[model samples]
Target: MIRRLFSHIDLMVRLLVLAIVLASVLPATGRGYVIAQGVSNAAIFLLFLLNGLRLPRTEVLRGISHWQFLLPLTLWCFGAMAVAGKGFASLADSTLPSTVALGLLYLGALPSTVQSATAYSSLAGGNVANSVIAAALLNILGVFVTVPIISLLGGGEGISLGADGLLKVMLILVLPFIIGQLFQARAKGWIVEHREIVTWMDRLSIAVAVYVAFSGAVSQGLWGKVSVGDWAVLLALVTGFLLFGFGGSWLCGRMLGLSRPDRIAFLFAGAHKSVAMGAPLAAVLFPPAIAGMVLLPLLAYHLLQLVVSAPLANLLSHDPNVG
Candidate 1:
């Protein structure tokens, strides 16, 4: 059981470590940086295009009717989590770099993950269909909503998104997704047929984005700026945010009188932040150096969520009330 749980995490860690080390050693500079940035942007565009192809409109429509489940879930994810992120960022501002501190708020503004949330919900005997719809809706909304939230909360913290940044987001993320939806009938089938390839493409795009971003940061002295004590503080704060995400989401479910399965769906949907959205959005919203710094806390949170969620899902699967 333990082996099964750690196997996936082990592979994820290895890949991420490789990306980080590669970025550090051969950090992109000069004309190479420009090329890397272009590649990252193109990969992100394709990644969203594939995302749009995969998510069915029917699922989104069906899920919208369940306001009882969806409303609180949305509020918790965007409202409560955003507020918590602000509070944590305030706490970390004095201890960490300003950009990294602002990342806490950015993390809160992001949406729930689609793939992992639905997978864990199914594993925990939750409403997989609801999980799918909830995650999809949030991601769609996030495309429009996340930047506004950041601009609103992060204006004073040197994180404002000007017109150019907004346009970049539309071009890189939103435009490709709209195109994918338009061609979904034709391309979705091919995407499904080549699911393995599509999945790898998703991972590769994210890795490339991270690599470009981190490379910029490394070249700008990222390692020298962030010390051992700063790492400890970052980890501690991220763990606290994780706890609040899971615990507060569960309590919200209970308070709302959700059935066990629906609650399970809500729990995962509301708690998990999407790095799928984070990495690309950061690339679009900030320069490579700042984007890399902003991503530090999120990357840590993403890995820890995976580690914590596997065990939590296993435990939830054993709950007698989960039916």
Candidate 2:
């Protein structure tokens, strides 16, 4: 029983949860906040560097060739999810807070997560290569697509499309990836040999990001701003959003005549949102006052997805029929 329980929970989840607890307790104002922010930024940059180095070029090429599979996945990530976000907000009427609702809509518009999606897809016997390429493209396009969608939804109030933000995305996320890909041939053997090191780095970076983001929120009296009832409603909406993504992706992939591996890729790539990018993007997009509120839903959704997906990935790994 102990082994079974331990097997189900991922270390990354545990670290992130711990980080949140610590963030809540720790002092985030004055010099501490500045220090936390700097650490978070550095960790994030390194995380992307490892991500670029680890991507398998062969799978990326294969994934790109299947444009038929890619098209719907893209549409679902950007279009269907965005529509569902607004629809859920409307359904909430006056129950949901405006800031949280706007956050959900923005979350929907954000891109798929590269690291977790690729990792989960690989664990589930999915097409890792295709996932890698698809996830990368989504983030790249996300820099452009997310801002526009947020603007359309009135979530872009006080947000400016700064060249610095776009450049930051490229510098932190894309540039490292390109460099890694460039030297991939030379590093492939070493990277594969030390894959576990890369995984830990990814987890640590995310944990730091969570800590910094929540530290700011905690400092701002996040719990005071949001009532228990509001929290419940937001949780419910986030749960519904995830369920829709998971179920719809599986159903739609089948309907589109995808192979089992392709379906698995679709399932993960369409369902997972980029926690790696969410906080930084929010910082760039929203005002400091509302940014914490806007960030809460994204953080909640990020943690929840990892919890839900871990077991699903385990099941898929064991199921002989899935691969």
Candidate 3:
């Protein structure tokens, strides 16, 4: 009975909720902010390093070789989703805050999740190899794609990155990744052996980033600016966004004539966004006051997708026709 109850709960979602609550209640003043930022930065780098060490290079190459699945998945995740976000934001401008609207756009531009997407793909009896490749490539490119996309979307008000700033951000993230990759062949067994620890480290870093971002916003009167009604509207908008992504991707996958497993790959990989990438990117791209709001939609979408996808994965797994 206890196991069943625990299985139903989303621990990551709970952790995020706790972070927000703590950020609101705690005094994250000068010293707190300094310490949090320092810790958050280190965590972010380590998270990427761990990812590089664990990334399956052979699977990625094999997945990419199958262009039939790769092409549509890429289009949906990067191109189509981004345009949809802009359209939604424009349509809802009067109701949603500018920061929140931009947050939706940020979500659209961000990459598909590697771990969750792959896990769901496997659960659903999908083409796990292809899912891994699609997810991996999207994230690898997201660091490059996201910055330019933000710049293109009216970056005059601090959304823009100067050449040096862009270079620095790239180097900070990319250098660690390269270093990890270099050590991966030698360290792969050890890294994979301690996979759970690495996973928790990544989650902890994101939680800390959330705490730091929200604490800064709270200190600057975040709750004062946002209303209860705003939360309701944001919830609805985020739900709609997820539905659109999932429905559209599924339809496109079918229309493109992908096989069952390949379609499942697209369905899972194309429909989700990465909070791991989103949180750190927001920290780099937006100021603290607005970063929290920018993060709000992502937090909502991330939790929503997991909740919705899990049941869908279960359904697909049980269906004899799916695999």
Q: Largest TM-score belongs to which candidate?
A: 1
lDDT of each: 0.88, 0.78, 0.82
The parts of candidate 2 lying over 4 Å away from their true place are 1-8, 90-93, 114-129, 158-160, 283-289, 310-323
Per-residue lDDT tens digits of candidate 2, residues 1-323?
A: 99889766667667867887897788466787888677767787777677667766776677678789888999999999888877776655478667777778878888999878989999999988788899987876776688888788665554665687667766766677788888888988988898888778888887787777677767877778789999898899899988998888888888998888888999999999997677666754664456667776787788788888888999988985753
What are the root-mean-square deviations of the candidates from the true structure over C-alphas? 2.2, 3.4, 2.2
Clashes of each: 0, 0, 0
Better of 1 and 3 by lDDT: 1
lDDT of 1 by residue, 1-323 (tens): 98887565645455666778999999999999999999999999999999888887777788899888998898888889998999999999999999899999999989999989999999998999899999999999999988777777777455546787778888999999898888898987798889999988998888888888899889989999999999999999999999999999889888998988899999999999998889888888877778889999899999888888888999899965542
Ranking by lDDT: 1, 3, 2
Candidate 1: what lDDT?
Answer: 0.88
Residue 209, model 3: Cα distance from true site in angstroms: 1.4
Of candidates 2 and 1, the better by lDDT:
1
User: How much is the lDDT of residue 65 in candidate 1?
Assistant: 94
**Model 1: pairs clashing at backbone N, Cα or C within 3 Å:** none
Summing lDDT over every window of 10 consecutive residues in candidate 3, give the lowest-scoring window: 151-160
Q: Which lDDT value does model 3 have at 270?
A: 94
- RMSD over all Cα atoms, model 3: 2.2
Residue-by-residue lDDT tens digits, candidate 3, 111-172? 99988999999999888888888898888888888777755653544474577667656665
